[model samples]
Target: MAQFLNKLIPTALAIGTGISLIDSSIYNVDGGQRAVIFDRIAGVKEKVVGEGTHFIIPWLQKPFIFDVRSTPKNIKSETGSKDLQTVNISLRVLFKPEIDKLPWIYSKLGMDYDERVLPSVGNEVLKSVVAQYDAGELITQREAVSREIREALTKRSKEFNLLLDDVSITHLSFSQDFTTAIESKQVAQQEAERSKYIVLKNEQEKKAAIIRAEGESEAAKLIIQAMASGPGFIELRRIEASKEIAETLAKSGKVTYMPNTGNVLMNMNASGK
Candidate 1:
């Protein structure tokens, strides 16, 4: 019985060891995940392991899993514009490792490949693209600038076995001096416009005054000529003035009497007077 027990113990121990080795060797590349094998003697393998259960030899080979999912990263940089103005820029990049290049990425950058490469390359692309545009252009042509950055960053990331799903500029700001200068410029423009308007208004007023004076002078000349011809015009003007005054008094709800004796008198006893 002791002999049988000793043999059974060794067999069970061997079986347990094998099970443990199998468990360690088997790895699952879950959804949105990929794996690369690293060999103890041969280094990283070139073949990428797809999703599902994959096996690797126990200590001789190890699996590195990577999430092949789009990730968002933010990068901020302070750079100079083409006009030599200082600008602060923020960038957002969505990126993932190329599935086919997983082996290379694992070999070179490990699991944190985006961390190792994105910020440096993102800042590089942002600085380069932003430096080509003036501060004002960055504001006016924001979409174009973002497109350029996306193109440049996409090109740059390819060299590191990365795929850029999207790239965009999230925020931008200039130095306080630049901001103040812009405000001052806008104020100056507005003041200039107001000055133009005022000048035009003054010119129009001057023209109106000249026209009024000319009209009055012409009327006086005609009146003098009429008076030289006869006193008829003066008589007619006095009658018109008297008629106008009578009409005005009538509209005022007052009673007045005009006499041919060259005098006027009001009715002292009127209703509502």
Candidate 2:
């Protein structure tokens, strides 16, 4: 039992030492990661490597990893419009560190580059763009404003070895009072439009009525002139009316009966000659 114990102890110690050595010497860089090498004696080195396994003298040099994949950052900023109204803006930026300049970025800005730089630069560009337009234009021309901000950020981000994938203005808002004012203006405009429509409709109706009245008056004049041009029209109408009355009386069976005398007599009462 003593002999077995001595051999097993050495074997176990060897296995543990081997594992420790492997753990220190080997390092893996994941996909989409950028790693920079730093030496204990010489300080940070310019050598930068991308994804996969990497080797360096253990305890002499070390690796710092950075994700070069596209990442989104949110920025909430408050600025003023051209009309001096306070505008609150929410924005998103898709960005990544330049792979080739990973070492350079580490040397200058360190790992906190995103926190230190992107917000200030974005806010500056945002304020400048907002200052160029009024509050109303900001809503109407949002796409234009976003495009301008992108162009400006691109130019500035390159200086810091940051590649900007995209810049988007996600939200634009005004104070409660301003929003209420806008709503009131819209309502007033709608009301004015309705009033104008009603006035036009009433005018149209009045014009139509006048046209009908004039048409009736003209027709009456034409009829009177036609009747006047017919000669003996009144007398002809009277004779036709009498004949119609006689026919009506005969048909009614209420015609009066009267005795007819052969000769006319001037009567001398009670005496005949």
Candidate 3:
């Protein structure tokens, strides 16, 4: 019975040791790369699980994990315009280390890349570009500002082995007095334009009235000249006018008086005889 118990104890001990080895031999994935570090044992690459795990190393190389995801850096600065007015600008930058150049990034800029590089580049780009524009231009040309900033940052980031995804202007602030003055000037200019239109419209109406008057005067002169042309023409026109009057009276079922010039002529002839 003692011999049997001793064999069972050894078997149990061996099983427990195997279980411990299995637990500690997991693989660790770093920086989204398949590159992994082993914990204590070697040749454990086959045991790697999805994306991340603990692994056994031969105690020679140490592992450092870097985040492979896109990171954001927010920066703010005060820049002077060409007009020498200080404007407060805030920007948010999205960037990440170039995967292919990660080794150079790690070597040159180190882990505090965001802290050291982002602010300096953002400020330099913003201030340099803004200094070329006046306060009014800066307010009106937001897209230009964004483009210049993006280009400047992209160029600067290349040296640091960074990939610039986007640079966004989050906020801009100018003096209240400057804003009010600009608005007031715009309003005055609009009012002047409206007044000029009104004056032009009035002039057009005056010219149209004068043309109508001139047309009416010319028509009256033509009618007077036609009437004075001859008595026969006048009598013919009177007869036509009388016929039109008779037609109108007939439609209304009314009688109109007609002068008898033939009777008057007969009486005059009998008197002469």
Candidate 4:
């Protein structure tokens, strides 16, 4: 019974070792991952694996897992504009590995593909794009800039086995002096506009005053012509003025009259005389 148990132990250990080896050789690739297989004899193979259980020759062969999902990377760069102004740029990029090119990507660029490709390519593309625009244009037309960057990246990314999902220019800024100059220029423009409004208002008022004076002159001329046309118009106007004076004086609870010779007409003996 002891001899039989000893033989069974050796067999069980051998079977357990084989099971462990098989488990180690098998790679359970998740949904978001892709794999590249390497063999000692044939070197890195062209066949890549998707989301499934894959087997590799242990010790002689290995598997490298690469995340194939959309990933975000933040980067920054500085460059000079066409106007020779210093500009700083911050970027956020969405990217992922191309599924069909996984083997070539792994073999050529390896897992640190982003580190090797994105910085240099992004730098070159950004600098080239920025060189076309001035500092002001960069701020105002940043969407164009971002679009240009993506376009350039789209073309360039193909070289590095990557698909550029998107690129965002999160923030863009300039020097303090430039900002201050812009503010000062805006303030000066506002002051100039205010001055123009004031000048316009003064001119309008002057014109109105001249128009009123001309109107008064024309009205006086018309009145003079009407008086000349009617012989009794002057006398009638004088009589109207005298009547108005008389009415005003009667309302004051007192009465007085003067003749054309300027003698006052009143009852002298009303109180004592």
Residue 177 lDDT in model 3?
80
* Cα distance off (Å), candidate 3, residue 141: 4.2
Pick the winner on TM-score between candidates 3 and 4.
4
Task: Point out where model 3 deviates above 4 Å.
Answer: 1-25, 28-62, 69-74, 107-112, 168-173, 231-273
lDDT of 1 by residue, 68-163 (tens): 899899989989999999999998888888999998888788788888998899889988899999999999999999999999999999999899
Candidate with better TM-score, 2 vs 3: 2
To one decimal, what is the Cα RMSD in angstroms of model 1 from the true structure?
5.7
Please provide, for model 2 over 73-155, each residue's C-alpha lDDT reduced to its tens digit, 9 standing for 90 to 100: 99889999999888999889999999889888888999988998899888988898899999999999999989998999888
Candidate 4: pairs in clash = none
lDDT of 4 by residue, 1-273 (tens): 999999999999999999999988898889999888888889888887889887877899999999999999877788889998877887889999998899899888988999989988888888899999998899889889999988997799888889988888887887888888889999999999999999999999999999999999999998899898986878888999988976776565444555773755444345345
Best by lDDT: 1
The list of candidate 1 runs beyond 4 A from truth reads 1-16, 201-273
Ranking by lDDT: 1, 2, 4, 3
lDDT of 3 by residue, 158-257 (tens): 7787788888889988777877887899999999999999999999999999999999999889878878886776788799998896667655523333
Task: Give the CA lDDT, 0 to 100, for residue 9 in model 4.
Answer: 100
TM-score of 4: 0.75
Candidate number that wins on TM-score, 1 or 3: 1
The candidate, 1 or 3, that scores higher on lDDT is 1
Best candidate, TM-score: 2
Which of the two, 1 or 2, has more lDDT? 1
